[model samples]
Target: MSWTCHLDETDVQEYVGRVLGTGYTVADVTKMHGGAQKVVYKIHCRNGFACVLYVWDLTKNYFQEEIANERVHERSFGGHSFETNNRWLRNHGISTPALYDLHTGQDRYPFDYALVECIEGQKAEAYFKDPDQRVRDEVLERIGSMIERMHANHRQGYGKPDQSGNPRERCHLVQLENAKEQLSYIVLHNGSIRKNHDRLLAVLHELESRIDSRKRYGFIHGELGPDHVLVTDRLEPYLIDIEGAQFFDIEHEHTFLELRFGKHYRYFQQNGLDPNRMLFYRLHHYISLTSGGLKLLHRGFPDQVFASNLADYHARNTLRFMEEWQLDN
Candidate 1:
């Protein structure tokens, strides 16, 4: 039920005029699309200016999942916050976008624009699909190093939470709760597919129990995939499209990375990552995928190969992760 929007130059000029007074004008408006929840617009102002606009969907009848303004606001908080956190990440050497102006009060302007520095890079998906093995390895190494830096920055509190109710913790609670609620809709919403409902229910219980054991884990991207990663022409890696950023159970993020690059770990090690942590994350990544908790995301996955392999991998790792990590053991 979502649609793409392309804003004209006139639209941008007016928006900038409204926000920054009569003298200023919009140089250009570019659409940089990636996030599923919201549309992003990159902007350039008349006087050597640049920024981005994060638009949320509020035109729907039913506000479900990440659709509602409530949830959308929760995910992004605001263009201002995203700008601040992103700049903070960059300051800590995370290679994120540079903040300019956030669209916090952009209602006067139809298409919101947050001024930002544009990143020059290729998407991470191209790294794996690139035919040259050496190039792929180099790209993967840069990717791993970038993610490590991000985690290091996060641990240093670039995106950590404080009790305005601990944004990280609150975000995690929301994602888990949202996932549980979605599971209930299997019978109500999906198109006539039913099997082992009870088993699925049990899996949910197990996931909850595991997450509860470490309710105070830390911040997570909430949503992680190849698309979230950007590789610059200079071979720098950056994280973008944080529209679904949140604090979630650590293992979920681990699963996300493993699912995408698990088989390439042999190369990952040559890049100087700890094998045990990588293995742990990879195994739990399997747990994160096949676990009933992932049914909500699998709809967009193509073919049975991905889901079936995920399921088989999850079964194999269920005992391993639980026993080794003693998660709800």
Candidate 2:
């Protein structure tokens, strides 16, 4: 679970030279700021051209069983799927970084890497931080429109995309089971939640029934939020870290957007989403995040204090989701 920089300056320069012709030299490679799990390096080219390079983080803190499955499926061993998803979205008129080159690490680089056109813009989180309400609202509107368009590209099943741009049906059960497992982990670790285990399990069972019986599925950014959106000076929003995206209930996505932004934001006003299922998925997402942090805590990866704070924050949010569900009832 300890991820360190595997590629050095020389490796990057050589890779850039190979990708961009002999004259294009890498002047600098600086780590870019983002919440993504991959190591992102902004490579400055001599001719004023810049590109972003991402190396897969192999040392992810996953459960032992999860790691075994990942190895069997060869997940994160290369950037082919990442390129595929990016190209699929770009073909559908979504604004995303153009892929320049992808190396699976079997050829040259020591790790799987992707070189893509660098986008010049501030992350949407910065806009949210702005004191001006007008700026925030404007950005919110743009984000909402983008989300709608992304949802327009749908598939038959629920999960990650396959070669045919359809959801990988094999991942559907795994995704649901994983959610249930995370909820169980949360209940087992927290004393307060343990007392209400029966109630929580009943709610989860109901939510699972609702989700499993649904046939509607749409392409969605699984982790859509301000942090994942980059807004240019012209206010154009570009999405990043789309590897986790999949075909799922669009209403689930809507709930995520509302939670990240505000439920009263103009975006939610534009559409009517099933509030009950939305809140159910909201708790699922919240618990998954909190559980991931707890796993990190168990592995001694992130600083214990930071991990504790993160788990606390998400736990509070999860409780709020439960309260909202009760109120609706």
Candidate 3:
């Protein structure tokens, strides 16, 4: 079951020039960072303005037949998210790349993609080696506040008193259930994969109960790893790669923020960075990492670097969950 992309291979360059506009002379087609679902590219058009093009592959890993069917009905999750940023910028005073042109081929493959304005800047990750702690602290705080803004949108109108008790939204819960069911396919047949997966699921089930007790609900970015956030030269934040985005537990995003920032938590402690959100954040991290681990296990595990990280992180997470919470007897 390979996905046959709707992209007219023969006409991509021609289409870019004609449909989107001239100057998109296909400077070069470099593979975008991250996974293979949507081919990302920084296409330097013949025109002065550079635009990033995202080509959706109907057969990519996440779009594979196994799990997409569960959460794949909305073909334009990425596009919708782009629009969210567009609106957020227009309404909330943030600066997002202006959307240029959109291309959809429902008549052909029921797929949609867009050519968007590219913000000229360096990625935030590049600043890891900066010598100034105060500068890094400001950047970190800026990032945190931006995330808090998003969580605010999800819980629009809720005040300070409403922050702590929001329950998980249904759509995110559906994704969780979908992940479990899809992974169960491999786990039941493969012993090692199943063992690690079950450990993760057990933790998630407990997290689910804790989430259920809340009366509040808010939209969550779901996937907020450092890769998705960008830092421009002026210290501005731009969040990219949101196709996998969904409304879920707001805490679900905290794990990556913690993991990425926590690596140097002791140093960040002087800057007022709190590691308090690591709990629920780790829960979702376990869920996402296990899902990836099970898939990779079948695909021949990646480099030992990543494999070892996943193995260690997954095991630590499972053990930590049991030690942290008491389950109902």
Off by over 4 Å in 2: 1-5, 34-36, 60-78, 108-110, 131-133, 163-175, 210-212, 263-265, 268-270, 300-306, 323-329
* Per-prediction backbone clash count: 5, 0, 4
**What are the per-residue Cα lDDT tens digits for candidate 2 across 81-156?**
5776787789889898989898885565545788898889998878866788888778878887888888877666
Tens digits of per-residue lDDT for model 3, 1-329: 12222355445577677866664565554445545346666665556556776666555445365434533322324455455545544465444566676666556555567776677766666666779977777676777677666655544221122124223334335545754664566465445556666555766665555543333433444556556667877888776665544334455455556666656332322232223334545655654565565555555543546754664566466456655654532
Sort all candidates by lDDT, best to worst: 2, 3, 1
Compute the lDDT for candidate 2.
Answer: 0.70
Clashing pairs in 2: none
List lDDT for all candidates, in order: 0.52, 0.70, 0.54
Strongest candidate by TM-score: 2
For candidate 3, the TM-score is 0.71
Instruction: Encode model 1's per-residue lDDT on 1-329: one tens digit a residue.
Output: 12234445565566567766677666666666633345676666678756666564333111234334353235453454465457556665766666555665545554344645567678878777778887887877877776554444233212333213343432334544544454355434232213434444455455444432222443556555677777887767777765445433444465566666657634333343333334434443443444442453454533356555655555555445545544443
Q: For every model shown, what is its TM-score relative to the native structure?
A: 0.64, 0.84, 0.71
